[model samples]
Target: MTETPGASGAPSVRLTAGDAEVTILPAAGCRIASLRVGGLELLRQGDHYGCFPMVPWCGRTAQGRFRNGGVTHQLPINAAPHAIHGTGRDVAWDRLPSLEENEAVFSYELAEPWPYPGRVVQSFELTPDSLRLTMGVETADDSFPAQAGWHPWFRRNLGGEDVAVDFSPVWQEERGADHLPTGDRIEPRPGPWDDCFGMPDGVDVALTWPEQLRLRVTSPTPWVVVYDEQPEAVCVEPQSGPPNGLNTCPRLVTKIDPLEITASFTWERLG
Candidate 1:
């Protein structure tokens, strides 16, 4: 494991496994400062999901108006009038004890009276071969709705090369221009893709580089969202819900007395 100085100038922990180098910021709620695998970086800077990356509402919130539990909630537009991700990414997190060298646990509580009333705990682990991230959220009320996912920015390399990705299952199509799902799915042909996908168990997603480097992501989650803005990097986000999930799955809007959700991804380098 390697160590680096954090934004606070204090000693922060950094772990290097094979071609992956991860920096853990304990003071900043144990946020993942950087995650690079096979020389490809994922997880955008200044972007987080409270501790990881918040989904359900990734990107914009659409004027910050959405229905929840048959009631409409007006969320502040952090990025314009859109909700943009969730509250967890911007909130502070507390560090927890762990025995794994590359494992980190963070905890946060949104009291009953808090803006986003829910208790959440997140864990991030990076191995020499892969990365595993998980999150659990519990609420005091049995009616609060929640969605979770990771937002990592991946590098496309310096030579401006196109990376190819392979998924086990077909891709899901979006219902609207806002990138919401239409409850319909399709196979990924040669075209622009910016939507969630349903992956089969133990499915392998590979990022083949022109420089002869291959990065792979294997996970239990059935859905993966491939996001790219060109010339920067691609994001292969594994999510429990599609973008604008509340609008897509109204039943998921209800609050939970105590809810727990877990999602993970593994990254490895190929010869």
Candidate 2:
């Protein structure tokens, strides 16, 4: 399928299968504006960022405030003192008609500086090499704390070479000095990273473009961040907690508990 004119005007959506292609923008925040595989182009061609979707709360929620029970809420710093990646990629998304053509669905609504009152629902499925993603956050009345993830900029050089980031991660959240996450957990530090990693047996990672393609990002969500210092692009981010995690590991999204997360990338091609 295909369309154009999105980013609030609504329309963008493309998907193929065998040789893989994707280009969903559903009003921009449904992001993933391109992901060609055999024909190359692994993301990062931009409309701000290629693969985005980090709702309710995902990374950095420190100075932007948090605390739900007694009420704290602040937000809106927009990555200066914290409060990065949330507000659902900065709004606009609501596509859901799905007859199936690689699967798609989107939704949004979690207003203000996000004091509560939620909705966020995302889904995509694409498959040729793989791309499944899913996200959630709900609140019929209100509860609070939330998180979800996927922030793939990718593309560190896909002409062949310059994308190496494999992962094992068991610990490593020691990042502070305003980068947030200093609850300490250290040990896997090395990357040209922005920090945060812990696998709990999920959240796998790998980017490798040594000869061509290799993307493997998986995620049952145990947390992941890994920014590659950016010469161009390379972020892993599978987040669902960590990075102030709504004032340190919280995760309640009322109306009968709703706050889900998922990620999957899967790829292969090297020669």
Candidate 3:
């Protein structure tokens, strides 16, 4: 895989705080390659990276089809039968110039198949115990529907300890056979879920690995999708909207206002 510079000329970026460390790859969709807190790895590091940025839109768009301003746009179905995780994960992002050791930013512009002219900015702020992620999308010439978020695939176990999830979302969005929300919000069900959920207040989830580590995920957004079907990893995604949200609850980014969201993951050593 090709690598990108941390700034204008640096090959890569690494942030360190206490025993915590983070590696950001600007070329690989500006994704987080690794997030290690002490001797424990909190993220699942692999070909997809530990975490990736989902921009312009989060999740699927219903068979890769959506209508805006009377124009129908079709996106490439990267996830089979649907366009998933937005195009940001498949494109190159420009690393913004910054001198901070614990912060990095990357930017990307909308291109073909998206049928929109806009720019997306993603930033990461790292501390001794947490990583704050922020994303924003905006169009200068026209208003375009958009969403933003992160997909962090966390390891199911840490230091040989099984992971446990704890959260209380307001409702679960019943998923259809195609994995799209059915527009029905029912009581939250027990995982392994690959569905979106309503968080009337905000997104807050805690994951604990007994005798290993404890971590908390928080976002101000009202929607979150939790996927725990995998034996190796679990995903607790926070986003501005849900799957097929373009047709359900579209958030338009105009010349004056942009769609922006922020989420933070804090971890602590246990045992």
Q: Pick the candidate with the highest TM-score.
A: 3
Q: Indicate the residue-level lDDT of 224 in model 1.
A: 69
The TM-scores of all predictions, comma-separated, are 0.78, 0.36, 0.94
Global fold similarity of model 1 (TM-score)? 0.78
Model 3 ranges with Cα > 4 A deviation = 1-10
Better of 2 and 3 by lDDT: 3
Model 1 per-residue lDDT tens digits across residues 104-134: 7777776422245556777777776666777
Report the CA-based lDDT of candidate 1 relative to the real structure.
0.61
Q: By TM-score, is 2 or 3 better?
A: 3
Q: Which parts of model 1 are misplaced by more than 4 Å?
A: 1-4, 8-11, 16-19, 26-30, 37-52, 55-62, 79-81, 111-116, 158-160, 183-189, 200-204, 250-271
- Candidate 1 lDDT at 3 equals 58
Task: Name the runs in model 2 displaced over 4 angstroms.
Answer: 1-16, 19-67, 71-97, 104-120, 127-134, 150-163, 166-180, 183-206, 216-235, 240-244, 248-268
Tens-place lDDT per residue, model 2, 42-90, is 8888687898888887777777888888878788887787777887876
Ranking by TM-score: 3, 1, 2
Which 10 consecutive residues of model 2 have the lowest summed lDDT? 1-10
Candidate 2 structure, TM-score to reference: 0.36
Q: Candidates ranked by lDDT, best first?
A: 3, 2, 1
CA displacement after TM-score superposition, residue 12 of candidate 1 (Å): 3.7
